[model samples]
Target: MSIKGKVAVVTGSAQGIGRGIALRLAQDGADICLVDMQIEKLQGVAEEIRKLGRKACAFQCDVTNRSQVFEAVDYAEKELGGFDIIVNNAGICITKPLEKISEEECERIFKINVFGVLWGIQAAAAKLKANKKKGKIISARSIAGHTAWAMLGMYSSTKFAVRGLTQAAAQELAPFGINVNSYCPGIVDTNMWTEIDHGCAPEKGVATGETWKASVAGIALGRAEKPEDVAAFVSYLAGPDSDYMTGQSVLIDGGIVYN
Candidate 1:
């Protein structure tokens, strides 16, 4: 499972699951290109990767921007000397009922969650094909993607779209030896989950913390998901062990929404 001497680009790597994935990849001996709009936090993650004895570069990028996504890949290949894996982990979650989801909100989340992954697939495939290298393209999905939940219909829709993109891109890029897959997480103990809990609190008529507790109540593992849990799976996806796998939107949510 070693990815030693490979180079990887991880988007939204400034915090949470992205940060965990970047660090895990570095720990597995892959040089990293950390991409995010949060420049300072990206630098911090880069420094941590450096401490792990892996080359790291911090590149600020808006994943929703097609050109910026392409440039980020270019920068990664140039700075890290190769591009073997791309983890399109940058995404935003919106909590709103389907009935009340406005046009603007729908567009915003779709741009970040759907279009961002699309551009990532495009950029990564292009680079890998040009270099004649086999690689992996991973993206972030959610449990909502597998089964739609209340107040997260629109968010779920975008994730489902990501699953579609992953499958289609996998087939299209298979000829080039590029694999496309996604990770589906649930109830992660991250700022994003905190935001989701808060958003559900008002509708559920409960306090913020209570909503989060209610959510964790359904987990078979009896605990909230962690960044490391997801990172561990992503490390496999980015390594040789998963080379035979593609177009899979795997659920790493402690047995939640099992498929």
Candidate 2:
């Protein structure tokens, strides 16, 4: 599982799951390229990684902007000498029932969660192919991706698209020794979940904590998930041991979703 000399480009890495992944990879000896629209927080994460004795750089990237994503990837590869992994962890969600889902919301979710992933795969895969290097491309999917969730129609739809894209990329890139996969998480105790809890409260006529408690009840592990929990799984996917596993949406959901 050693990746001492590797470089990883992680999008949406200013906070939460993306930030955790970048720090974990850096702790594991990989140089990190942190990408996010929030340059201040992104640079903070880079500093944290640098403090861990790893080479790290922060790039201001809006994943929805294809050119920005490519430019960030190119800059990382150039600065780090090569790219070994790219984690497409930039995504968003809105709390709206099917009846309330709007075209604008649908388009925005797809742009970040789906199109963003595709753009990262295309950019990173091309770089690896041109260098004849085998690498890993990991993305963020969700439990809603596998099974539709009530009040999250648009988000679920976009994540489902992510699952398909990851698989297709895996199949196409296997010949070139590139691995593509995604981490599907559930009830992670992140800011995103906090937003979800608050957003669903009014709709469900419940207290804020009620929504979070109900979600945690379904997790057989009997606890909320952590960002580090997802990061540990991503670390595995980025390492040599997981080289044989590709095109798979591996769930790290504390048993909320079973395969």
Candidate 3:
């Protein structure tokens, strides 16, 4: 699919799945702007995009911060000419029982996962609306968004919120030919899983990457999902081919969630 003239802004793209998606979109011909909290790593990803022979820019944006996201979005619009696509890939996760979860932790998780998506949507809404032309807004809604997890409730809360956001935004944006939707990635084999595994493992007291691999053994697919796996789906969502799809959340899990 050729996204040749489309300008794409991807958040949390400094590494892992976000990085994969950003690069994949660039490869598909979209001019790419990478957003992340880590400047150095963001630069690294930008370098890689350049190597791919695509236009690239990196913005140090903490999506949870409204001003930062807005400024970055404006800057990107200025630098890239205009906004056409937005991939709200920035988010955070925290594993804790509802009762045991501290206020600070819960707030932090919601701020990043829930509010982050909202902020991105709000900032882009005007620009996307003004175009009244074809546009794409894709957010990262995880498999956890569709189901409950024993200790992942705090994190799951945000994914569910993203789902709601996608549905609502799609309904509102469709009039302008801008599609709004989300994609759920099931138990992706990103650094996130490693951290979750080690943190949850009581065997080694703290996982040393040795026992981490077994954390996802219960998955039906027998392996964790790859970053590219999710990226492929994201590419389709951001491409012209998926114009008919809106306000939907498609899972990229390896059968992790059959429903």
Candidate 4:
């Protein structure tokens, strides 16, 4: 719970869920390092953190590009005093019918979602090793990764990969005292959903808040997730209390999966 002097790097922290995570961590006393492709937006999030009186910096990074990722992580370490926690929050989702899914689309999704997580892990592991501290590696995954969904085949596959990577990395890094885990959120009110909503097939019904609300009505808890909701969990993992939890995926799905 006490992370007063700790440092944390959150990928894709410019907005939505990632932004929520960054702000939560900053408020909890972690020196925040934000990574995102959009420099302008990243700057805004950085400014917000600074207003909270916390040290915050934003790095423009394309996680799919290994060289850029390496440089960004190094820059983060050098400029922000190296990070004590790595949040692999950068990811992408593409919805298409199985037959209509293109090879290019699949690769792009994997590059960002799966490979991106790998890049963050590789870069942060080195930083943690150099600092001689047992650090934490956390990522955002979706419930779609755990359960199969129609028309979300490509995204589901990538999510599954994220879950596997987290488990394997946990095993490999446990000896070094580094912890790795994944956060699985379900049907959250995120920009991703907004985009999907706007493009929903007419047969699926009009894209409205009521329709979206009904979609998740099957959940036992009866609610959609909020970015801040997930951010709170990210804070716990980055702090000391979750030091014992690693290489596991925590679901923030509002009991939808269980329901």
- Weakest 10 consecutive residues, lDDT, candidate 3? 203-212
Better of 2 and 4 by lDDT: 2
In every candidate, how many clashes are there?
Answer: 0, 0, 0, 0
Which digits, one per residue and each the tens of the lDDT, describe model 1 over residues 1-259?
5999999999999999999999999999999999999999999999999999999999999988999999999999999899999999998888878888889998899999999999999999989999999999999999999999898899999999999999999999999899999999988999888899889898878887997898899899999999999999999999999989999999999877979
Query: Model 1: how large is the Cα RMSD against the reference?
Result: 0.8
Enumerate residue pairs that collide in model 3: none
- Model 2 C-alpha lDDT per residue in residues 124-156, reported as the tens digit of each score: 998899999999999999999999899888889
Clashing pairs in 4: none
How far out, in Å, is residue 202 in model 3?
3.2
| TM-score for each model | 0.98, 0.98, 0.93, 0.94
What's the lDDT of the predicted structure labeled candidate 3?
0.84
User: What are the per-residue Cα lDDT tens digits for candidate 4 across 62-133?
Assistant: 989877777777777777775788899988777566788888998899999999999999988887887788
lDDT of 2: 0.93
Per-residue lDDT of model 3, residues 36-130, tens digit only: 99989989998998898888888898888998887877877888888888899988777556777898997898898888888888777777776
Cα RMSD for predicted model 3: 1.9
Question: Which segments of candidate 3 are over 4 A away from where they belong?
Answer: 203-215
Candidate ordering by lDDT (highest first): 1, 2, 4, 3
